[model samples]
Target: MAASIDAYQREIGPTAGQGTESRDGVLSSPLERLSALHRISQSATASLDLDSMLMTVARVVRETLGCDACSVFLFDPSSDTLVLRASIGLNPGAVGRITLPLGAGITGEAALRREVVPVVDAVSHPSYVDYPLLGNQPYRSHVSAPMALRSPDRLIGVINLMTIEQRTFDSEEVAFIETAAGEIAVAIENALLYSETDAELHNRISQLSTLRQMSRLIASTLDLPQVLELVSRQAAELTRGLAVEIYKAHPDDEHPPELLSHYGAGDDVLTDRVRHQVRGMVDEVVGALGTVERSIQVSPGQRVEVMALPMLTGRRAVGAICVYSEKHLGDDPEFHGMLHAFSDSAAIAIENAELYDEARRGWQRTSALLQEMHHRVRNNLQTVAALLSMQARHASSSEATVPLYEAVGRIRSIAAIHDVLSSGSISETTVGVIAKHVTDEASITTLPPDTRISFDVDADDVWVSSREATVLALLINEFVSNAFAHGFSDRSEGRIEINARVSDDVSVVEVKDDGAGVPDGFDPGETSGLGLQIARTLTESDLDGSLSITRRPEGGTAVRVTFRSRRLPEDTIT
Candidate 1:
């Protein structure tokens, strides 16, 4: 017996001598609780490492309370379960390997209720659970104290202290253990906060590195297919996506473009049902003004997130890219920004590839080729207009359907410029002809059937390049559409007038509407809606022109845009 006591003292200190007077005296002293408290507080303050602190806490609580064993179980919010993080006096192997559901046993109950449960004899207690896998130590009584943070009782874990002999725990002993549990709770919260911040920082750094790689890929190759494949694969890796698919609308094809390349999990990444859904998402992005995100359910309870971005060459969408993943990254602003950055680079690469392909075909074919290109572009725009019409038909509200109608009108206006080029008039295309086409299309597509609206185009035949004609056409489209949609809201009749002529080596175009004028304080210089914003941007940036809106003297609004004249080769194609 003396030999056994001496061995035990060597293990934990002299105070651990079993059944000795010194051991009993030390356990009974008031200073023992204070000393144990001081030790736990010191460890908590010294270390931000949760596992080491939990182990120290379990050991100290078992020795101070004179118990046979101790275990600390931490709560997992994601799984809604308690995991045993630290233990002593049982199988050490089982320390970090066991879990119990909420309210499953005495420990679980304490954690769920945020209270201390003292079992005088757990062997006879109905709420006690026996797990032989935790080891063969037979504990008769135990106390489970919930470790929680205050101000709403956020439970972090439960601390269980057990004794071999059956005994009732006094209030003083329970109080001391609870104090230690409090310190453990603080340590757990601190560790979790630090871990989350560190992880976010790591992801941010990784995303920036991935974006840099994508930009390099863009600058490295004019091989559109190869660049598309590499960029898609890199994007999938950055977002941990299942796959990425790039689809480009070919101008020559009447139908929408096929998927040019798929990276990551291959074609099997999208099933039949998912493919149909993805096609619709891609179409919307190509038809709309900017990127769109959606959640698609690939299977009964499994959802895949998709980001559809249009590949634009200035104002026209040439194609779109779709990034797919099991997890949704739409809510993350940083990730969204990264998607836009990649989309911009992808657009530049696609445009460069198209130009290179055209150049390789020889400049001798440039005249016929440019004309053919314009015809193809016109066809693509008509296809977009058809899609928008279909979407507007199925839309649930006027607000939703209105944008589709506006987009269709804008697409057709650009198409009108191509229409004239396809007629063997590429350069020196009259702005008057483009304005007449835009006004006619907007009246047919936007104005109400019963509302009588007439369009008048009166101007000198001021000629500009196809690119210049495109910008002017879109400006007239937005102006006419806005006048028809917003200006005639209370009237049953209105007239839109388009006037263009040359002034001081500049083409000055004015669109006047005989409907109710804009609001008293409305500023056309600071327009906010998508349509007006597009018009304002094209005038200032694309046309190098200035736009202004003023109330007509005869109860209406008039908008005028003025820009310097510029000319390009009749056979130029970009």
Candidate 2:
């Protein structure tokens, strides 16, 4: 008994379902009979433990058949190939090294046909081959038997054996092998049941993980682009998925997966394939309505689960989550469940982002309105000054009251600026209008017809506000008036030129004359009073700027006022 045990254990240890033969005579000892029954009992026991069955098959074939080796080859229905799953004979490497096509070898042929191949002599059989690992042993005769532990109708795999010497197995040995193979089929069926149970546990774990991470991401950000990017990355990482894609559902197209972002381990070619499928045509997206199961068509006809999670901001679908997978993980139930749960978070984040965008747009509109109002206010003030002018002129006595008259002219010049600003659209304006009006109003054109004076305007029309317009216009009037009063008193050739130009976001207004220059070291802020004080106040306070009085290269003093224009900085101010 002990010797038989040693032979079975040592020889079958390396043979994985390897087929061997037993003696032709019946089992003479009670222990031998006992071992055969134990083999059948292990096979008959109903358990979903496929691994335990493989181990039992290896041990039983060696002990009962009294063979050197045994091996089990299971038929994978998807491929129709006999995959060598477990073995007890041959090298440690060769245990899983071999695979036989269905109907290709002795074991494969037997499994494919669900028949028994009992070879009485090894050399006579056509299907037998000299497996290298068993060359050192005295293998001669063998048997191949088919068994199905999964679907009873389908042959699961084949059980094979090899013997030490050339011999034929009798009726008793054949019956024992047949009964043993049937028991193995039962073991296989049990193992598969266990696989399904395990697979379910894994799916539940995965679904929970996805829900947790998705919650944090949807709450963290209001930026639409950023949120989309994060969603793609998180889905891939959490699921250990082959690929992940996020799509935005638009009005024109249903499936236009606005590939917000993606992350994965594959190459650019592979990732690009995912990009195309998620953004599939509109018909495809609409087809996803109410219908649960969907798949994105990939380059190699791979079936990736297409999940449509409409990023519902209110009732409409603002976007969707188009998830994909290259590998068919049997986690479909959990994957579908999680997809539905995460839709709420996705919708909330999208809503928040859209609201923030609307608020920003409103703020901009209000700012434009305020700027327009300021421009008009400034223009209206200038117009009031103009009305005062007509009144002052009718009230004036003569050139004898020239100082009083001069004061009124200055007042009315500023008044004209306020009127222009008030009448026109003030937000978009030009100070040049004010400058031209001032020089024209204070010139000989308006003075007595005998004391002739002409105005020369230069430079482009520099557009500015009615506020800046009034300040700059009044200053020009004062400076030009002073030149006419003092320097051009007994004029040979007198001309006042007002030039306004803009540079480096600043507006420059220059008043020049071909008369006597300013007194040695004269500052308009210091010397020219009443009008000058007002001019200084208008420049520094009203315009929030500066005034420089310089001698023109041609002779007269040019009063240059530099100031800021709210709209001037932007070439296209609305």
Candidate 3:
């Protein structure tokens, strides 16, 4: 350190002949000067915080030099100016508000020349610039030294010292201040590096958080327009851009891409040049299946940067997201990675939305066709029933009329199932609904005009497949017809009740009538009636179930059928 100080003194040329004394007639010996230099160095290297470190250095410099005021100015490369960063005696508000370009004043000249400048009378100096806002005092002497580093030598800032009395800064004092300036420069450089690293880390964490949020948001919906809008807004926020636009690529090259969504100010403010450039970028990104960037000069000394990234699903490009900003972006690999992740998520969401739309359309068409088929079938059955009815009405014998009417009843029962199926779900229906339809048809066609026959149906929300519903409807019709034909022959008033329920994965349907009981030797399995035979065959074969007929103790007959209920898949009606 001593040898370096000696070199600096020799480089500064000869000192003034007068001894080192302040306006108070106090002399500063060589030992005292060395102590002050040591103190300045310690203060500069004490902290990594730029503001606190610079302020401490400014205070120490004032005390060490026995000056009335001290201020530290840091260089801003982007604006090519020196900004007042810290001060010990100037107006507190002017610390960060004051600025000076190189060669503008005494401080700027010292920075521009990379040397120490001393003026015995600051007001009389040619380069002196007065700043009234800085709380000016009638000081006669001033010194400004540029802070510079050695290796890769670059100017960092300038340090200014002012006194309230006329003073001449000797060569030794100037050299000591220069040495202190060097220490301050090194500290500033280290602090700046720390700040940059801290900012970069914070930015990375924020990007990850934003990407996670976007992923969850886009995954919540399958609506195409909503997905596009979400992606546009998220892209703008992610890049900190002024505007964002999403373009969907057309299948044909003759047509330009469509702007699906946009966020930020409308395109009225965009120049023709920018619009053309964005179009070109979109085309490039789509063609290359990668990211593309372009910068256009919007006006004198003003430029706009645009980046377009392809939204890819697998190897195919679905669309492109374009971001516009006044600052340069997309140059960092980390930034590029974040963009790719966001674009990939957006592409997947778009693809899923489109697929869902297509599937929904196909389902609608299928439903329409099924409805038409059911309608035609119901019409054909009604025509058949009408023919049977006409035949029964024109029959010569009552026995012949009875069979025809029975056939008509059977046809109408099947048609009723189709009627309910056509109106709602094609795959399934409630047992209660089918029972209601069948009983309604029977009451209309089978009941005599003078008879008071009422049906009471109670089915507790047991759902079945369309095919099962047809079989159950047929079975119920048979039981109802039998009760009307035989059970209530001598009675003027009667009631038939149909009840269906499910228990422990087993389905049970019962039909009972308060009328004459079955004969002593009657057997369902041995019955000669065609309807009973059909019911038994269907119950055993198609339904995979058992049918039972019993005499009710209350002077009636009840028929019960049990089967293993089919398990409905997810989203199927219960």
Candidate 4:
């Protein structure tokens, strides 16, 4: 077995200084050593995959050196430690589970020194460290070489070799191992660079996708509180923050910044120290109309960072969004860009919601004023009607009382329109509502008490502008008045029916009375009566309509009016 081992080492290049003799008593050539190194170099860079490349290199190095074990440790800058990445001959489970600090053990010592360290008896070395999980191999000899790149002088890791037998490595063997370590370092650097680039690209895509989703959510509502809440929650998620707060800056400087929304942790769960720090950040950002960042130590050896970005619309500072985390997020340019983008979107949403709220309040004020004006107009008309009614009661002649009574009815008809307008939107009302009010008023006031005159009003639910409704009401009152005065003058009981129909943008209102018909050959166009003349003039001019009064063949009078039904505009309330 010893002779075979010697022959193998001679062919593969000797790793320990033995007698300068091969199995056949011939010296190994320098060409054989170069061939061994070339093989090791090729194995180191065989794959771009870090784990595969490291494992392959470890196996090749162990075989080339005729050693019992080889292991590769990679440097973790974040933790300032060397982690076992790949190994052969050691316990496979320990490959990635073992770790050592920069100057903790033999491997770490070599990494710190940037040189090769050899131990004749690893168990007796003062700097040696053992891992029970790696299993006991009774390795007596060990060598640790640090892997590094020269141009930039960056430390990659350390490569370790162990032997079960007591052996001493020569200068040539150490040089060979150092060259292999150099090749491994270059491969590791390349792989790490590729990984970092890939991670950055993936992070960018994820951030942009998150921003898009957040923008859509923010724009979905015009409610100010809802928008602020959405922005706070999404901002916390995008930044991976422990907590987030949105603060709205009051336009008046006397009022302090208001916390509009909060996400992540409840206020009772957060430490007072954290809340204070966040408040400070909010004040600074809002006051300066810019971004503010700070780092505060929450506990011993624990620090948290806070970043607040202003929500700006044009030159106005509307609010600020603050994110809290344990990471040094303020140092990252990508995080800044993402936060700024989200902040801009949040600002626009807040501004739009505020504008909508302001406009709604203004409209409410204007509507209230218009309603009050309608009420006053209705009151004045009713007063006029009452005064005229009192005047008719005092009149001595029936002829004088008749004209005054008719004027009072006309005034009341105009007042009915204002009464409807005051109760709701002034822009429009239903024709049916106006007809009912006018006909009911005429029945109560104009019909004689001794003679029973019943009124039946059937009007369609046709909507018309307030102006048209007023004219229609007066025309209906005039027709009803004329019926009460002339058509039912000598009748003990009479029926006055008012019917209105709307079709194809035209309206037709017919007031028919089962009472005395008009005098023979009566013409409404030439009537000297003020009531008929008023109705005819209103139908032609204001209502853009025509009126015809004809004696019904069944022995009563029917007055019909035809007009274009003008609907209110879209923005006007009906």
Best candidate, lDDT-wise? Answer: 3
What does each candidate score in C-alpha RMSD? 24.7, 12.7, 7.4, 8.0
Worst 10-residue stretch by lDDT in candidate 4? 18-27
Top-scoring candidate (TM-score):
3
- Candidate 4 residue 417 C-alpha distance from true site, Å: 4.6
**What are the TM-scores, per candidate, against the unseen true structure?**
0.56, 0.53, 0.82, 0.66
Model 4 pairs in collision: none
Choose 1 or 3, whichever is better by lDDT.
Answer: 3
Q: What are the Cα lDDT values of the candidates?
A: 0.78, 0.64, 0.83, 0.81
Report lDDT (Cα) of residue 194, candidate 4.
75
Alpha-carbon runs more than 4 Å astray in model 2: 1-35, 43-49, 133-138, 149-151, 220-226, 234-242, 251-257, 264-307, 325-335, 353-574
Worst 10 residues of 1 by lDDT: 14-23
**lDDT over C-alpha atoms for residue 406 of model 2:** 69
Off by over 4 Å in 1: 1-35, 63-66, 165-167, 250-254, 265-269, 311-318, 349-574
> lDDT by residue for model 3 over 1-574, one digit each (tens)?
3343234334433333223345332225778767877899899889888899998998778766777668899999899899999876566678789999998889999999999999888999999898876654455688999998888889899999977567888777887788888888998899888889888888888888878877786668888888878888888888899899888888787877778888985655367667777877788888899998888777777777888899999888888998888878957987898999998888888888888778878888887799789888999999999999999999999999988888888899999998987889887888899888988888777766676888888894888888899999899989988888889877788998888889887999999999897876568998888999999999999999999999998879989999986647543322
Q: What tens digits encode model 4's per-residue C-alpha lDDT throughout 1-574?
A: 3343334345445444232221121114578677887888788767877888888888888877777678899999899899999877666778788989999789999999999998878888888887776653456788999999998998999999887677777777777778878887998898788778888788778789878977786668788788777788788878888888888878776766777888986654357777776777777787798788888777777677788899988887787888878776756876787888889888898788778778878877887888898899989999999999999999999989988888888888888889889898677887678888998888777888888877787775667888888898999899888888888888888988888888888988889998888866768998787788888889999888999998988888999999997773475521
Native-referenced Cα lDDT, model 3: 0.83
Candidate 4 lDDT at 312 equals 83
**Candidate 2 lowest-lDDT run of ten:** 15-24
Give the C-alpha lDDT of model 1. Answer: 0.78
